[model samples]
Each structure stands twice: as structure tokens, then as C-alpha cells.
Target: MNAFQGRVTAALADPTLKTAIDRTTNTARSKRAAAIAAWPEFAQARELGRDMKDHVIANMEYYLTMFEANAVKTGAKIHWARTGQEACEIVVGICKAAKAKSVTRSKSMLGEEIGLPHALEAAGIERVETDLAEHIIQLAGETPSHIIWPALHKTREQVGELFRAHHTDPGELATVEEMVSSARRNLREKFMAADVGISGANFLIADTGAICTVTNEGNAELTTTPPRVHIVTAGIEKLVPSMVEAMTMLRLLVRSATGAELTQYTTFHAGPKQPGDVDGPEEFHIVLVDAGRTTMLAEGLAEMLRCLRCGACMNHCVVYRQIGGHAYGATYPGPMGSVITPSLDGLETSQDLPRACTLNGQCHEVCPVAIPLPTLIRGWRTKAWVQGYEPLHTAWALRIWEFFALRPVLYQLASNLALRIMPLFAKGGWISKMPLAGGWTRYRDMPIPQGGSFLAQYKKRQAAK
Candidate 1:
């Protein structure tokens, strides 16, 4: 078995994983549905968001340059990193130059994408995750499974155990609110003592050179405002034309992500503290990491750039619900991650991701910006097959199927014969096992075909009509 399959097998064996994923994803799915239903102009907003993203992607350099100029005018330094490692190095260098000893960070997928935490640790800087879910995963030394709900896979019991293991408190934590209060009390000290803070940008406005951050917990505000130096790490594709368009996208983002009208705190950092400002960072830096995004834009995969980092697609994904995000073994998970991971990490290393999907199109249906996730996944599968990444057995099977498929008469005859022959092995209208097709029947029983091929059934109905 491949690495993904191996991980999936292990995850499946652990029933608690699926149980946790089911509860969380179900709630998220319901909330998103209700939020979308409540918004009368959601469809129009989705189209506008899609068009705006497409426009920015078509003129990526223009928006990026505009953003850089405006940000520079505000005295905010812009660092361009072509790769994840370079991005990590830039953040590390900034910390070292400022003589930062402790760093507080908000939950940033970009930071995780570049392995920033490890880089900071390697640089001898103590890093504390200010976001509660991020703090939980950080204490456990684990990567985020879900994008929005980072530690959704962990139960409250598991969280209590993690806190008890790390924290000085030996009291039994019974409730989530109590756990939150404990974490808040613990993180407040870290926030005050932090020399620097790092965060992710939800949207970077080219007109004003401001980075938009949306969070429900207000940890992002605490992380950015308390620290002396503030660093924003984000992908180049996050650039928008202005706040007008940013608000439009934000509307779709919040509802699609967490089923809320808006997050509690939506802060924008243009630059360092001004002459009249009271509490703001002395240094403001924005690291625009290309990290394969430019390549994706240059290639035909620019549609994937419209992603808002919302976990809506994954929340409704049946496959993701079954195996959970850890099985994907990437920074992003679910339908979006299936395409993003392979697109960024290369198809050779992540070829199995595209094939893992069921092509149900629920992801495409619920996507805020109307990304054709299944279509993109199909493109990845095609690329993988063309690049000789598919297995020899699969290739042969497809070739044999193609031979009959090209000839309708042969295809129909073969299908009818198989339909007739397969039922001979069925017990009580279900096949428990089959030779050479054990992969399908091993996990679940396949119902015996009652009629003939679809064409035959259609013809019979037409004749009767």
C-alpha cells in the first residue's frame, strides 16, 4: 500500500478519529448551510469573489507591486520569498536582528506551510501559539489537521490531558470553557513577554498596503498588538485590489468558514505605530511567499488560487469525513488540499491525493468562490497518469477497459456478459467477494445487478413509453 493508504488504514482502525471528525464536520456543514441560506446575495457575492480573484491572478505582478509600494510608503518592509524555506529564513533573520527571545504567534497556515515554528526553535527563540487550538496542537507537537478547526480531532478529554501534562495545574478539567479560561490565563503571560509576533494575512489590500486578519478568539489581535515587532506571512495570491473587494470576499469567507456573519475581530495592520498611535508594533514586515503559487498561476491551475483558506469543502467532503485530515499528511487537507498539496509539493510525491477523492462534487457545490475542485482533482489525476506516476496494474486495467469502451457493441456485450456472470457468485442478491475485484468487495458487499446494462434498461423504458 502507498503511504496515504497506510495512514488511512491506521486512522480507520481508530474509531475515535472518525467520531471526532463526524461531530465537528457535521456541525460545520450545518452551520455553513444555514449561513448561506440566510444570505440573500450569497450567489452574487460568490460570483464577484470568483471574478475578483481571477482578475488579481491575471495581473498578479501588478497588484503585488502596488501592494509593495503602498506598504513601503506606510514604513512597512516587504520581503519577497520564492520558496517556503526562504520565507522561514527571512522570519528567522528578522527575529535574530531584533534580538527577539520569545515569539508569540497566531494560527497561520502559511507559517506552518513554511515550517516557521521549527525555524524559530532552531534559532533558539521560544515560540508560543496564542490561538487556543494552535496552542493545543503546539503543546502536543502536532500539525493542524483541519485548516479552520486546527485541533478538531482531539476530544475535550484529550485536551484536558494535554493541558495537565504541560501546565502546572493538576486539577481535573471537566468543561471546554474551563479549559479555555486556563489557556487564556496561561497565554496572557506569553503575550506580554513576547518580543515579536507572527501572524497570517487573510487578505492583503493593494490600495492601502494593509494585511487583514480575521479571528473569532481575538488571539490574533493580542499576538500582533502586544509584541514589539509584528510579522505577517502570507501567500502572494492573497492580494486584493482594495478594501471594497476585501469586504465582499470577507462576507463569503466568514459565512462559508464558520457559519458566522463575521468574526469577532477583523483587524488590519498597515504599518508600525504612527505618531498618535498608542499600542502597536515598532516594526511591521510582510513576507510575501510565492512558494509554487506563481508557478500555479503560470500553469492552468490559477483557479485554485481563489481559495479563501476556508474549510467548507473539507467539512462537507465524505472522504475527508471518513479518513480525517491527518491521513492526507499535508499542511492542507480535504478537497482543496488534495489539489493544493500536489500542486505545491509536486504530483510525484502526492499522486495518491487526487485519486483518494470520490468525485461527488459536494466540495465544488459548497465552495465560496465556486472553485471546480473535482475538475481540478481530475486534472491532477490526468497529470499523474501522463507523468507515469500511476501503477502498472491500473494502467493495464484502464487500457483493457478502453479497448472495449471504444467499441460500443463490444462494450455492451461485455457489460451484459459480466452482469450475467457476476450474479452467479452472489448470495442473496449481494456479492461478498470476487476474484480480481476484491478491492471493491473486501470492505463492503456489492449488490448484484438486477437488470442488464443501463442502455438496456433505458431502451426497455423507452419501448414501453
Candidate 2:
């Protein structure tokens, strides 16, 4: 097996991981359903969100320029990064210029994508993840398993163990409340001591130059407030034209993400502290990272830019439900990852990602922004095949099937013969081990064909008529 297959096998073998993923995802789905049911305008809001995002993506350069102009007017420094490495360098330079020793961070998938934490550590600046889930994963030295739930794969017991091993107190860590309190006590000091704060923006309002952030635990509020220097890192796709459109996106985001009408804290930062302001950052910086987004847009994957990052697609995906996020082994996971990871990371490295899906269309059904995830995934699969990325055996099998499929008489004869012969190897109408399909049969039995093929049954019915 290949590297991707190996990860899938390992994830499948972990029952605990499966249980955690199932429980969390199931709960999220139920909550989302209830929220959607209560909101009669959900469908209309989704359309508006999609239209606004499309408008921004279509005129990305214009909006970005407008945002920078307004943001600079508000006394916020704006920096543009063409790549992930450049983005990291920009953030590191900002910290260095401020002479920052310790930094507190809110959860940013963009930061994780660009390896911001490691960059800060390499520069000898301490980084503290203030988000509860981010803190848990940071303590354990693990990447986030889910986009919204960074430590969704871990159980309460595992978190307690991580705190015991990492936290200074090692206090009683039995219940959820106790663990949360312990984490808060530890992080309170870090927040106070932090010289710089780094955060991700859920939406960047172009007209007003406001950075919109929503968080359930209010960690983002603390992360961005107390620090002397504040840096906001986000992708170019996060731009919305104004507050009205941003609010529309926010409505879709909170409900689809956590099944809440609104997050506990929805904070907006326009710029540095004003003359009369009591408390805020001394300096504010916005780092807009293109990374591979421009390339993706130019190459006809622009619909992906509409992503709100609510993770409803992941929660509803059957394949994602079974394997969880880690099995995909990318920064993002699930249907969205299957489509976008190949584009960002290169198809040669992640060729297996698109093929991991069953194309059940649940992802498309649940997406709040109406992204056609299955179609995008299929596009990646086709691209991979065109680039000769498929294994030799798979190529040969497809070729052989093509040959038979083109010859009607021979195809029918072969199908009839195979149907007659397959049952010989079956016991009690199921084949536990099939020669060519060991991958499927290894995990579950395949039922033998009990009757004639569809074509034959159709022909017989026509004759009767």
C-alpha cells in the first residue's frame, strides 16, 4: 500500500478514534439540523453568502486593494504575501520588530497551513495557543484532526493525561469542567504575559477595514486584546465587501459550524487604538496570504474560494465519518480537502485524496455555501489520471474493462460466465475473500450475485411485454 492507504488502515484500526469522531460528528449534525429547521431564511442566506463570495472572488484584486486602502487609513499596517513561506517571514518579522518574547494565538487554519507556530519557535518567541482545543493539541504535539474541533479525535481521559504531563499543576483532571478550569488557570498567565497576539479572521470587511472574529470560548477576544502588537493572518478569499455581507456570511458560519445562532463573542477590530480608546493594541497588522489561492482561481477551481470553513461538508460526508480527518493526512480534510489539498500541495503528492471519496453527494447537500464538493473531487481524480498518477494495476484494470465494455457480445458473454462462476467460491451467498478485490473483502464480506444482470432482466421484461 501507499502512504495514504497506510494512514487509512491505521485510522480504521483505531476503535477509540472512530468512536470519538462518530459521537462528535453525530452531535454536530443534529444540532445543525435543529438550527436550520428553526431558521426559515437559511436557504436564502446561503444563496446570499454564495453570491457575495463569488462577487469577491471574481474581483479579488479590487477588494483586496480596497481593503488595504481602508485598513491603512485606519492606521493598520497591511502586508501582502505571495506564498506561505513569505507569510511566515512577514509574521516573524513583525514579532521581531516589536521585540516580542511571548505570543498568544487564536486558532487559525491559515497559521497551521503556513507553519506559523514553528516559525515563531525558531525565532525564539514563545507561542501559546489560547483556544481550548488548540491548547490541547499543542500540548500533545499533534496536528488538528478537525477544522473546527482541533482535538476532536481525543477523549476526555486523553486530554487529562496531556495536561498532567504538560501543565505545571497536574491537578485533578477527571471531569470536563475540571479540565477546562485547569486549562483556563494555566492560560490566564500566558495571555497576560503575551507581548504579541496572532489571530485568524473569519471575515475581512473590505469597505470598513474591520477584521471579524467569532469564538465560542472568547479566547480570541483575549488573544487579540491584551497584546501590545496584534497581527491578523488570513487568506485572500476571506474578503467581504461590507459589514452587511459579512453578517450574512456570519449567520451561515456559526450555525453550520457549531449549530449556534451566533457565537458567544463576535468581535471586530478596525485598527490600532484610537486617541481616546481605553484599551486595545498599540499596533495592528493585517497579513493577507495568497499562498496557492491565485493559482487555484486561475485554474478553474474558483468556486472553492466560497468556503466559509463551517465544516458541514466534513460532518455529513460518509467517508469522512468513517475515517475521520487524520486519515487524509493533510492540513484540511474531508471532501473540501480532497478537492483543495491536491491543488495546493500538488496532485502528485495527494493523488489518493480525491479517490478516497465515494461520491455520495452528502457533502454537497450539507455545504452552507453550496460548494459542489463531489464534482470538484471528481475533477481532481480526472486530473490525477491524466497526469499518469494512477497505479499501474489500476490503469491496466481500467483498460481491460474498457476493452470489454466496448464489445457488447463479448461483454455479455463474459458477464454471464463470471456470474455463473463467482458463486462457486461463495459460501452462504457471501464471498469473504475475493481474489482481485482483497481491499474491500478484507474489511467486509461481499455478497455474491443472486440473479441475472440488469441488462438480462431488462431484456426478459421487454420480451414478456
The per-model lDDT (C-alpha) reads 0.92, 0.91
> What's the TM-score of each model vs. the native?
0.96, 0.95
RMSD of 2: 2.0
Residue 413 lDDT in candidate 2: 92
TM-score of 1: 0.96
* Candidate 2 C-alpha lDDT tens digits along 336-436: 99988998899999999999989999988878899988899999888888989999988999999999999988899999998998888798879987678
Q: What are the clashing pairs of model 1?
A: none
For candidate 1, lDDT tens digit of each residue in 199-219? 999999999999999999999
Error of 2 at 197 (Å): 0.4
- Against the true structure, candidate 2 reaches a TM-score of 0.95
Q: How big is the RMSD of model 1?
A: 1.8
lDDT of 1: 0.92
Off by over 4 Å in 1: 421-432, 441-451
